[model samples]
Target: MTTTPERTEPSTTAGERAMLEGWLEFHRETLERKCAGLTDEQLRTASVPPSDLSLLGLVRHMAEVERGWFRRTLAGEEAPPLYYDDADRDGDFHPAEEDTWEEARATWQAEITRARELAADRSLDDLAARTSRAGESYNLRWILTHMIEEYARHNGHADLLRECVDGSTGD
Candidate 1:
């Protein structure tokens, strides 16, 4: 298990970087606020009757997704994916006994840290210049906006999932 990174408050910025940074900060706060004061078991608890959504799962999945977009896609790194393989595209949330609460939180921290580092070096206008999973190219601007969309969407899910987990809600 990795160590959780230090807490980061929102920072000031300007221009397109500001926009992306603001979105990232918003989602980061939303996720943390949702995860506040929850136990490992509570984090892993499913919401609703049939849904397998859990805060832990969401955290892990977002970590993987963030790494994929920011680190791998933008930085041109070659790595096996953080999650999802042949038999388990959704294996992130369904962690085995080997995964602890600390591990889950750490995973998220690491990815978020990497993302911040990447964002610090690149502008939203920087070209992504890579093919996506569907064999289409994208610009950095598009990825930045897409990330905001992705986080906003999942954070919405996190809101309800958190509510189901502990009756907590808000920005």
Candidate 2:
């Protein structure tokens, strides 16, 4: 049984790095909170008939995102996709139907841990090894903000997915 990551998102506002970390942590915790107490089946249940979205899928998706951003792009490591493939780009969310909540949560937590470790020694101004869709390189500060946005958007979906799964909702 893997232990869940600590989720004490800082309440006190601080510097730019601290603020970004707090918001990112808050978003990560929101995803974990939505998945908490859910059965594997509940976590795998899709939001709707046409939509493949689920709590488990979101967790997997975020894990992939974290690895891509922090390891592949930022760290200049030869990191490959953890879930998806060239033939099946959305594999992370699609094949998640059979994923256990425990497995998905553990993988997500591990990715989060790795991302924190990668970013610890870097400054906000550090440049990434990858470029954005616009063909422009970005910095750690941008990556952090992008991560916050990514999780925030997905967490909103998680809100609906959780509510749909069990009618649970809150901050």
Predicted candidate 1 versus true structure: per-residue lDDT over 120-162, tens digit per residue:
7766667664577898776677877888788889889888998
Q: Poorest 10 consecutive residues of model 2 by lDDT?
A: 1-10
**Quick one: best TM-score, which candidate?**
2
- Model 1 misplaced stretches (Cα beyond 4 Å): 1-14
**TM-score for each predicted model, relative to the true structure:** 0.84, 0.91
* Clashing residue pairs for model 2: none
Off by over 4 Å in 2: 1-9
Question: Mind sharing the TM-score for model 2?
Answer: 0.91
Q: What is the C-alpha lDDT of each candidate?
A: 0.76, 0.87
lDDT of 2 at 80: 84
